[model samples]
Target chain A: MATGDIPQGGDTIAVIGGGLIGTSWSALFMAHGYDVVLQEPAKAAWPAVPERIATALRQIAELAPDLPAAGQLRLTTSLEDAVEKAVWVQENAPENVPLKRAIYAAVEAAAPAGAMIASSTSSLVWSELSAAMGDPARLITAHPFNPPHLMPLVELFGPDPDRLETAAAFYRGLGRTPVFLQREAVGHIANRLSSALWREAVSMVAEGIASVENIDAALVHGPGLRWSVVGAHMAYHLGGGSGGIGHYLSHLGPSQERRWQDLGNPALDRATQDKLISGVGAEARGRGIDELEAARDRALIAAQLALSGQRP
Target chain B: MATGDIPQGGDTIAVIGGGLIGTSWSALFMAHGYDVVLQEPAKAAWPAVPERIATALRQIAELAPDLPAAGQLRLTTSLEDAVEKAVWVQENAPENVPLKRAIYAAVEAAAPAGAMIASSTSSLVWSELSAAMGDPARLITAHPFNPPHLMPLVELFGPDPDRLETAAAFYRGLGRTPVFLQREAVGHIANRLSSALWREAVSMVAEGIASVENIDAALVHGPGLRWSVVGAHMAYHLGGGSGGIGHYLSHLGPSQERRWQDLGNPALDRATQDKLISGVGAEARGRGIDELEAARDRALIAAQLALSGQRP
Candidate 1:
């Protein structure tokens, strides 16, 4: 892919896999003036992908009124066509290792030697997946939070140093901040933290410590907002000095340690599992999956725009 | 002391700790039509407290546009006078158990016999602190989040169940949702989850897994927003049919155990502690203790009001 294949002043990206993440990648790439070519499995996913991308763009427009004219985005059905001569190929496919291995092999075979093949896989080990490719060094995980168009984070990881750097630069080009999981860890960063919290929440509910609504209320009404901005470390950092986290830990650390020890490791017992399923199913009562997912996409776009200081 | 002396439809609250929480409690009581007499030992804490309280009240007013009236909040120097004749004593004293024990004993002796003495201690066991009061049962931990006026969560716990219920009702009357923490725990619901995440973030930073800004960005841009609405459990619940805690655990539980084992358990070593302190201090460089606290209080008030549908 030559610099000319890229838009005159802006970059061009080819997002392979026009599913949920693929659509988001397209919108984000296009929003930044990247001519995007999204490859889907068949004609079946074509219409839905555009609709999803369009809805997100509309939201991006709403959240950021000053956003630049979005780049041109098109959909395709051929992987070879999408990757041929493309500056960047962001593969958003099934997270299965075997499947990723296959797709990456093809991506490596079809794309120009210089084109970066970025995987949007949230959990697969980068080295293992990329090793199957001819130039394993070219593949890097540019894992965006769900609804890539909105969320500002992109967890980048790969065994190869140059590949990781290129992937990071590409994401930055799209106004997305790429966070390197310097080491490949399961669930990467955010999901791992979330999984821990969710485990505790489920245990609390299963143990009858508090109702589901009460727990949700506790968070949304408490640190959720603060965490949204400064995060736990920074929040605690501020919380410690001036008597922030440090003050808290010193005064309350021992107590926290004691509690930590007592927090009975509530494994997923059959009863607890039932409690969680029932509890969550009840919570999701009326919302349609498609609608909820669309809403998530919009929220993500708004969040991304907010972080980037761009028009959503 | 009869319920009549408790003041029908009205009462005064002596807030004996004029820190961030004390001021917020003052605003909350004042907003609900109760006169508040806030007492802080540090005379230096005087000027800033009132200014912060005023700012918080303005935000409270904006959120709860129909808030009763303004003149309900007052500051005082006499701790004895603050508690005298008051129906409720909200002790925002430091987290030190001995200090709280001493304050509780004094406040318990000072306030009307029927009055409730509530501690805002986040981690201290209630039974230990309550043991010091004249009517130990009257004491309870009404742990409010930072900027209590804004955040509506109050983790209520006590040695006595009846008293716990009464305290819960009292907080509910003040427009705060009190979740009964089954027993004393570190960080309570929200903070515990926060601590776990912060610990992970620290480990990640220590390991160079990601940058400070990128981790924070991931949260605010992703789960943070979702958490602000439905929170962790509900989020995983909607992750898929086989999602939520049960499915997550069954599918990824071993992985969680693996990750937990892989997680760095760095002690609060002197160097690391200082690193945290300096890092956070750098982030909060320009904002003084008072200013940052006030800003936090105001934002909390707005958020709390928004959660409770009281925000204008």
Candidate 2:
């Protein structure tokens, strides 16, 4: 359970399922100097995983250029071979329950008992995923936000506290921000909060209150920028002036509650869905997915560096 | 009614209040090269307004360095004298209804007939504030997020379409992002969406689901970063792959609805308030309010530059 006991640069780690998430995780592990063994069941994906990993590593280099050289990348088609000698196993299979269960079973059976097992699943609860495993205590949920190599969040939750602590230490050593959940939840922490905000955002558009471009602009220029530095609670605490959250709650909490009650809950019916698609298309303004994604990644890097007090 | 007809730089603007918001507005107007006449009823704030405006102008200079030379800052105690011959007036008085009504009434009597009057009110709707005004057509609500000099959002709504258009043009001329609301709502667009997200964030903490530091980290590292680049609607559109938002709604909308139902609605009772204060204190980690505010401003400046394609 000690931080130093976890795998380091010289150690080997297994990355099961070499899709976007898996490849990004591979890049991160390799960048941290851990030899990565990548396994992908999809035959077509085998041809592109290396290129994706390379792109991810380039992004990592831009974000943190001082890291040690990346370790070797070992590609394998067999899960057992990938996990056999790895000190840590990171499963990034599709979100299908049965597929994840089978993968976990294979990993538990093939990998060493002391090998730390983690999942990149965003939606499923750990208890459900571990139902079929014999030693589920070793398995933990280490859900990273999309583009795992860049985003610092890695939400860790598990049945055993010791394993969770071990997983936390491992992620921390890799220079990632790992948050531990007290219990299992549907979307964990970040996605759940995202869903809450998105629900209201979509409702505003569906109700014809504002256009898609305006809503997005409001966020990027308004609360979204603040949220990047402080959480909602802390923002309110600061808004309370010298008294902090206590004064804010006493004076402004009622208004917040009133606003919450008045919040929209528009259903995503066919008409609403059409409006959203068209609105987003207008906002896209001829920018393709690749261009938008690149812009997002660049902005994220700049914001991250700025948050850490580094001049971008 | 046309954008060209609206006042531009070098035009005189009357700022009716000299608090935090009013000072920020004055800084922005001055930075944009508009002569600003600041009127503060509280004599105690008159001496500090100049210092606050200086700080805000410095921050604005960091965000936008190519602006014209700042206009003259005229200090006065009489609202009538401030608005007598000004082409535009920005009211940032307290949130009380009657005080705003009286201020508007006085502004209408003293200001020129064509002067565009705007309120920096965060909560009250325009119709309520203009109920007693003889010329409500010229009065509008132009709500800005905190630190108006740095944040680029300005929510504009009014009874007159032409007036709203004029206000939009004016804010755009000042290099600010202006969102027009189709109708009035409590907390406007940004605050409402912020409250929705904060409700779930507070619920998670009050329910013992996660700690304050962990929740804030999850947001700053996860969705908050994405939000600075794209709004929720566009993010979901991109998340849907090639088919866009329609596909995402049909496939994942149900799960979003489920999450919305599961979202919490926690009250700010005494115990909850205390927990929030303690949590924020721990997160602050001995950093005072001034330090946190400075950090937030720095991150915001970096984010704004990155979003605009400038290398910070």
Candidate 3:
């Protein structure tokens, strides 16, 4: 646990916080056969963590039936006991600067010297989080997609190449695709693109070009399916016919720019927000959040299972 | 063929142009039991048409095993012969306005007066194309996604509700999802959102935030997978946790706007184009367009088949 080498299977890793993301991350780690010491101060939330992680583990097991036996999970209320002998620590506290800095101070004091501390932060950047850390180089921002256990993307950014590569290798071993940023950017790669798409989506609703149901339907049935197989750049590359993306840029670049120029920049004013809430409500058709999340997880598993055997 | 009612199964539908889109449309129509009259001005494109369509049909057949017996296909060089007896004329000419206008004139001259004339034009708006048409009310822009047979989206826009409704019903009968636009937008609904997403995607690469491979990998593994099951609005809806999109807009709307503001407006300059060509080439890993397209089609079919039995 005290080795400087990258943590591998059977290594004891500390997973701090027992919220949804923490539980999901712990499930992913345990399913991959790594011992997890989960720490959470709120004893009330501790009882539900096991069943939640077990459900997530079951979902992953369905897709990958040949996984190694799960590792041991020890729950604790004391942060020091959780990170005492750990070689890696994954912190999933809420995104508050003062609160996270306090946890990091606690972790640095108790965790083993060579252990890598990773932050599962989606919105906050590494600079802001690392500014208050004792050994700033020890912490790396590893932002997993929402519902971390089901989705495979983990965006990693830090100053140390060795640590980044170590984390990248570790994630890849666990069937996660880790995308590294050369420099820190707000929202990173995937969220930026998604936000841009949603902006235009909101504008379309606000302008009444199409209803929420139609737009959502169009996406699920159309480009969204293709996106599941290829990213935006590669989609256009294939769209260029036999000529590839070069041909697309040469011939269709003007048209793409025109479309970009025409794209809307609607503000999230009260009226626009009202339209969004109502529009998505109609699209939901009375499905509650739990039902919707269940449906989404099921579809994600099925779709990934479907695409698993095929090449990307 | 001359009836004003919507075209149903066993009816003759003319699929003009023997290119990929046209041939895929023919496959979809024929697979659903509609007799097809495919017209290609160049006889050089003739011998390859049927085989291409048969391949696409086979892909669809793998997913849907209980399809009706395919309708008869009659290929001809004469435009008049192709549309003379058809009740639904689906035109797939190139995007040249004058050429499309000419084809429309000829289609109007020969096809049944009451037949719905649907244009598979992706970018061109209804007003622009309808201006020169003999019966503008008959022409509805029914733009299908690329590889139309596999993709389910068919964006429909027309002035006349009866014609639009008829087209929508016919598409629905063929197991296609037809999303109607309340007003015509330049790139319609799906493509505009896609374009917006790509602008940010391209900017990420151009600004050296990440390599194209990582950015694409992030997307395919993360948001793209979620998107395939749910659309942007609905995904955000679910992201609001138990509170739904109402809570999301109220709580996270400010951050979303901040991300949107930081989204890039990258130009497809010479240098950027070179980066794209090289980057996608690396992503392709020496596979040609044919290989990529085949892989994309296989993934699409498999993914669709996977999600077919599951509720969305």
Candidate 4:
């Protein structure tokens, strides 16, 4: 795991596709004192990146008071220019394999030999995304949660373990917790769990067992609070009382299977989709997306601060 | 809705088990200034109840100051004596149908007719638990998360909504969040969602996609934080950006379905169980169950206090 291996000749970090995720990655890099070159071909959208990043930097600053002055943020429309002087490229492109492959091929040509192109992909995996990369080992899938500047999870997976470790160490230096995948899987780890959980949550709503509002409330009030402190596995470990998860499995494993069998596999058909849309609307309580996002950011920061000592 | 309707002739709340749940519920009832008659036939456990309740009360008090001096706590070995002067009964017996049924029948025979007997059974649904009750409507399933006094969820469901409302109002007055199920479902709301999430989480471990520690860390730092603020459904809505969940469902729904299909349905075979047990052991990082529990409680309190205003 060597930061020394980073191409010193190309001293800047290139962030491709300056959308929300790219903007967030830009803020995160800047907050940690790395000069970021962000590329967005959408000329109208480029104007919002700086201010969005500034807001994110302030939010990061609130959680971390002693952050250094942000690195200089550079915007570009050309992918060639963005990766020209890149020691590392954090690509936040859309989930299109062909476009991503083209960007990677182009990046490999323009960027320094040692520069790592990390994708901010949530849905796609490494094999498909890196199939077209000239140097596949140099391309790593670094998937950050929404608002990358705030959320500290970067799911890293690539062919090179040493490179992944190096990336993980660098993220750790920035106060991020990076989890490595032994192998690639769809949605990575967290999102798979999220989808599985939401499937049942949506099922409860569609089945009329509970309302969407109540289900969400139940989560935030109950298991959500627990998860913020401990993960699902550890929660059950602790839940198994003094005997730990072994006791839980030996004693309560049967009941868990029964519940799993009973869990709904409701399709996201039109009626279910409509129910979900309206339910989310009710849960929003007339608050628009902006307001809800603000509240979520606020709560995330406060929770992270409070759990700093206890974070896994 | 009708606290006044509680049988005034019997001026105490009967807690018909002295296990962990009973102890927590006893502390909660006593913390709210209700005299509690705790009945645990095991004389060996009687002495520990007071100290356990005291510990739970202090935990509750830490989250909320200005709490009144705790009400009286009387431990009894006989269920008849415990409920003889009970206005309401909160039964926390083990999840054995015959045992719980017998307790409910005995409580009904001795206690006032208007008393609402609430069961804190997590696994058994209302129908199974209340099958033998003379007045089935009088039996409400009030399932609380572990360490009941601290975690604020109380899932309420019964035959009658009015009675459930009364229970909900009472729980609210006690600073607990009560979520009602329009209909009974196995595992209620939070636990069902919890089971769904854990199944995927365990699959990741069993499949060696990630270590137990990394999976747990991913959760605490990522979706867990988001869930603490919102919920699985609302997180997607927010993730959809300005278009909300409707946009998310329309645009990302296919990807979600793909991921869901890819989700592993691993059985908890002995080998998988062994992996989980050892995985949790590694994740515990030499912390004993007691130490882990203290950390969990500490984090839970901090998170709750931090998000008190944001709580649903």
Candidate 5:
């Protein structure tokens, strides 16, 4: 991988939206000593996103002392200005397909032809998102977890394998680990796995077998930590010890089949709805989305920065 | 939860055993300021486990400066002296039914009735383990995650309800959050959830749907982080948004049902075994059990200390 070709110096990178993710992108790029140009026409999300970004940058700066200065990010109201002459454009606009198409058209017009354009869409397929772009090959899903300034992972998915490699290099240039998904599934890699687990968790809760807190406890204290390090396969592989995954599976496989058969298949009923709402509301204790999101962002920043060392 | 009930100035809490979970228990207790009395007869394990525990404790001390002095933990060979009048006895013996029964019996004799005897058994039912004890009530499963010093959760299980409360109170006193299982199940909560996921991951790997690393990436980068806070049910609730778990269940539940039906119940074939091993081996290449363990302990300390602030 020609990591050096991704530009290490002060090349301008445009952040096309100033929402939580866009501002986080700006802070991350600036931290790596890139010149970030952030544009937010909403006028309202302005300053708020940047301010939140500032708090995150300060934490990152403290935690990662050797990291390059992240104080060079500039915010503006003009999308054209942000996109012009940039080496890379990271679009974090709203997920409305039509609006994204218009934004991509505008970005392609404003940015140089050689510049890379990546979307931060969590669910939208790259084929659909980049269809309107002049050079759709460079348009990939460079989806970072919440508070990108902190979390070290970026899920890279799209057509154009070569461009995906280039996008991966770009993120790695900024000290982010990129996992290239082989296909453009709805949830991509992380969300799909998460959706699977969440599906079972919903079934459990809806079935009245476990409460929200208990279920969360089951994960956070239990396999959650293990998953953070070794993940499922490695964990069970080690769990099998010298026997490896095969021997372990041979012994435990039937039990798993049994459990699967016995597992509850929860459905949406009046009982389930009330149980879920009451369960989550009690756990949340009625915090609004903004407050909960802000708190989650702060925590996620701390968590991702902590795991940055484990980047392989 | 009475936090101050914890001894203000104990240098060592005896940890009997030097196995994976045992070593983790030693490191965490030591990391939290109590000196650890690690009693292991296996001379090879003695040198390695303490070194591992010390490395882990130091990492915890780095992330959380408030972590008490861990320098006081000591290793010894005498099981008799290890538990003599100790404030707490954390037993990490082998998981055999007879072994647990015998160890707790000895531990009951060595320590005062008041001194807590906690087990790190993942699968053994508490009633069986505590049956031979004079005070069966004192024996409770403080089933910690592997590398206990790092993971923030301890599953508290016992036949006696009052003792379970006491065990919970004691773990809480030490800045650890304890979740009480109303009744003992085979793997407790977290492992069971993980087993379910691992079973599915194995099925996926067996079916050639995704590689091992891809599956691991999907989880750690995606729902894993989300599970750290809100857990599975809440994630679905959020995923379903205003539709709630009820709507999600009615709509997505059948799809999961379909997936469940489609799930490959392949026996642990040779190819399947090889795939799981190759996948996990590649992932575990750089990270030894010791290194990943220490990191896990540090994160655990950080999480538990953070959560301790939330307790009323």
Candidate 6:
């Protein structure tokens, strides 16, 4: 199957590091018919990669079943061997700067000159990740939300505009949503927004405004549902009554600003931490971790399907 | 069908100020087999009430098909007639303080002694709404998300704990999820969290970190999906592996705090408003308001069904 940017038969992709992110990326790449070469130095982690990849593939099948059959999976311990014939290298090594630098240095030596190098780092900026690279033009930040194969967002940002475009095209070819950041920012787009919202949520609990259960319920039933379809901007756009966002700004924006000023910024002190821990326990309702995780996954898949109009 | 708190069959419910919120409340009450009396002073709005109720009931049927067949709907221009025999009164008057006070005063004089008078005001606190009432015990805040029949959250906050419990039971009887606030706060539980998140989202777009389209996609594809299933606290709890939220706080709480500090507090000034308007126009791709609204309603209903495991 021909796809954007890739060759008619698809390209050979190197997935360095066989942890959760690495395995999920490998599954997505292979499911889209890209030959995946996964390298893990830790012998113990290598055995788990295929199992995790299989689980991820099952999920991808449910969310996007029309894609072509998966390509072959090649496992290797040698980083040099993994990148020998690859067209793209997705580095998911440990978050340590020094460790990432060493891995990139090794990839630069062995991978083809035209191969685009992307880092799945959530914390570090592109400049920091590509500092040690001899040719940093090809290195870009392509951060994905957790469970990469399911979540469609792959936030991309970097200096080289051409490589960034190529990275975006590559991700799009794999049936993913690639959002390009105009510049570097801490926590990128999603995490920054998530952290901001969570801070206020934590403050609400700490201040005795509402219980943790009610907070979560309030979100899931209210803005969270609307957000799944239209997002914040468009939600406001519709709120403006056909005049669009400009009307909303002139009328309701002041109320939003007032709420922001009143929003809490509570510290994660010992007292707050205990409150949150106990609150979550009560909300969990005796459900085990595995049960809750499965429920979340099912709910996420259901949401994706519903948004796509695949289900009634 | 007998349900909690109400009479053996169903209680006579009054829906005052038949605007959007009142009509929605009427549809929800009628669908749950409760006799509903809806009051609207504006005669022009009365003609459209039936059509709006029919639309809302259709959506409700899809989301909660187990609900009993709808009871009768009675529309009236007289506030006295509407609340005369009601066992519960949901006041949905416009957000004007004086108008709400007058409506409550009339409701207080006409409604049955045991009737629970609740305000569906999103902005005003319980005290402010009940300030003009002689008996404020039954006058509580029972704010529901827009399209009340579809969205399950009914935020209940009031000075009377027993009445709040009764309100919760009544909403639960209607197959709605009622979240009880420990105390009164502006915007209640959901809107406050929503405003906090949107403030950051707007700041990101205004600062040029990303485009409006990308910001919306970042949320709908990222945290929005997770939020549909679990709230922020549980999300962090799961992120902590087996140790729960305490471990997450001990390890990653500092990073969250740092991200919070970096979050933007952007004002909705004129320039920012223009940028957002054009951004939304570009994202809309020429879809009209009615089309977009229908799409939102469909997606919301699908998400509700998916979460309840009613869909494959």
The numbered model that scores best in lDDT is 3
Residue A9 Cα positional deviation in candidate 5, in Å, after optimal superposition: 5.0
TM-score of chain A of 5: 0.88
Model 3 spans > 4 angstroms off: A2-4, B2-4
Candidate with the greatest DockQ versus the true structure? 3
Model with the higher DockQ, candidate 2 or 6: 6
Which residue pairs in candidate 6 have backbone atoms (N, alpha carbon, C) closer than 3 angstroms, thus clashing? none
Q: Go through the candidates in order and give each one's C-alpha lDDT.
A: 0.68, 0.85, 0.90, 0.87, 0.69, 0.84
Worst 10 residues of 6 chain A by lDDT: A1-10
Question: Which regions of candidate 6 deviate over 4 angstroms?
Answer: A1-4, A7-10, A309-312, B1-4, B7-10, B309-312
Q: Per-residue lDDT tens digits of candidate 3, residues B1-312? A: 543487878989999899989999999999988999999999999999999989988987986778999999999999999999898999998887898889889988888888888999988999999898877988999999998999989999999987788888889888888999999998898899899999998898899998888888888898888888999999998888788899999899998888889899999889888888899999999999999889989999989988875746
For candidate 2, what is the lDDT?
Answer: 0.85
Query: Is 4 or 5 the stronger prediction by DockQ?
Result: 4
Taking all chains together, the TM-score of candidate 4 against the true structure is: 0.97
Winner of 1 and 3 under lDDT: 3
Off by over 4 Å in 2: A1-4, A310-312, B1-4, B310-312
The DockQ ranking, best first, is: 3, 4, 6, 2, 1, 5
- Candidate 6 lDDT over residue span A190-303, tens digit each: 998889889889999999999998898888878777777778888878777767777778888888888889999899999998899899999999987777876777778877
- Computed on C-alphas against the true complex, the DockQ of each candidate is 0.39, 0.61, 0.85, 0.78, 0.26, 0.62
Per-residue lDDT of candidate 4, residues B1-312 (tens digit):
143363322258999889899999999888888899999999988888888998999899999888777889888889999988787899998888999999999998998767788889888899998888888888999999988999999999998877888788778878999998989987899999999999999899899999898899889888888888898888888888888898899988877877788888888999899999998889888989988888888889888888888643
Candidates by lDDT, descending order: 3, 4, 2, 6, 5, 1
lDDT of 4 by residue, A190-299 (tens): 88889999999989989999989899989998998889889999999988888989999999998788778888888899999999999888888898988888888888
- Candidates in order, TM-scores: namely 0.84, 0.96, 0.97, 0.97, 0.73, 0.94
lDDT of 5 by residue, A17-39 (tens): 88768877888888888898898
Candidate 6: DockQ? Answer: 0.62
